[model samples]
Target: MSIVAVLNTKGGVGKTTTALNLAVGRALQGRNVLAVDADRQGSLLAALSNRGEREPCIAVAQYVEGQALRQQVLRAAALYDDIVIDAGGRDNTALRAALLLADKVIIPFLPRSFDIWSLDDMSALLVEARAIKHVDAYALLTMSDARGTDNEAAGQAVPDDMQLLPTTVGRRKAFADAGGAGLSVLELPAHRDSKAMAETQALLAAIFN
Candidate 1:
């Protein structure tokens, strides 16, 4: 079993969205996935509650911090094939605790100046996390422009300690719409944007394969 934590020290970096989609996408792939919301905002829970009834089922849990969070994740490790933790937007006890157990950590950032700058903070946090335990980390560019040098520039800015995923998700309306409805691009109806689905699928493949 693999424990994956979707984390970024900065807010609005698509941490929750990535976590939600990752959990649902894995479930759709027939994996026994459990999504753990370690964020106090509860965005993951809110999204899952609105998920379509026909979509693949994904078990979920919430734990903010302290011993309980660590204990529960350990207990869940025996039951789920994969555990996806949605950590808060900042460095805290929860995030630190998650790092201790996560086998992999996905850090999503936009192709922007602020988001690029946040990578340093994340790198440092990961350094601290690694001091305690070994955890593989990756940087994923999100909300990238369809055609621009921004994506390339941002990809190059990723910290050396973190591997950058080749698949980049564009700034597509389909993501926002699907997120609002608590659904993934893969679960969108017949008119779903092909690019969105393709990007999401590519992301899952890059991470899970």
Candidate 2:
């Protein structure tokens, strides 16, 4: 019965990747999961198809556009144990509605300067989401390389007011290939015991545990 919205005002920051994998990752762990494709771009939907899901993924746009029955939205989603909304990279009505419904709002960003710089914008959006739903949001650092001491040090330098995930995804090709297959990084055998999976699992654990 928990709603998690994956957001970042800045696109290409692994927001969709996080949303896609985290949903599948949770489901693979035996928790029922529903992935809501809220972005009109249909990136999630395209990725879902690549993953070869038998069930129709519920696209919020379709619900809003009258292509699908709205009453069936939550009911269809409820068939799963967890619901994830891929909110794209902007602030809009759909994103707002997802925020109001979310129990946790997870924002993922890279370790670069622009990625770090974009935090303020997302934080403001999180504030707006909180103003509507009264829920706190957290940020997760993605695509990090420990060997790149600078990125590692940057994460350690985060202020107390900000939250940086303890586990980080090192530079790995598995992520890109896995996404192409509609599979999560966790779903990749090589990543099962990798740091990326550990970090992702830790994030999921924080939410469900």
lDDT of 1: 0.88
Q: CA lDDT of 134 in candidate 1?
A: 86
Clashing pairs in 2: 32-81
- True-vs-predicted CA distance for residue 161, candidate 2, Å: 5.9
TM-score of each: 0.95, 0.80
Best by lDDT: 1
lDDT of 2 by residue, 80-178 (tens): 677887774766666666666677777777878877777787666666766655765767777776564767666765444447766555566677777
> Which pairs in model 1 have colliding backbones?
none
Candidate 1 lDDT for residue 53? 77
- Residue-by-residue lDDT tens digits, candidate 1, 1-209: 88999888899988888888899889989999999999999998888878757558778889998467899999989999999999958888898888788998899999999999999998998888788888899999998887869899999899999999989888888888887766778888757799988988999999888
**Best-performing candidate as measured by TM-score:** 1
Please state the error at residue 156 of candidate 1 in Å.
Answer: 0.9
Candidate 2: Cα lDDT at 89 = 70
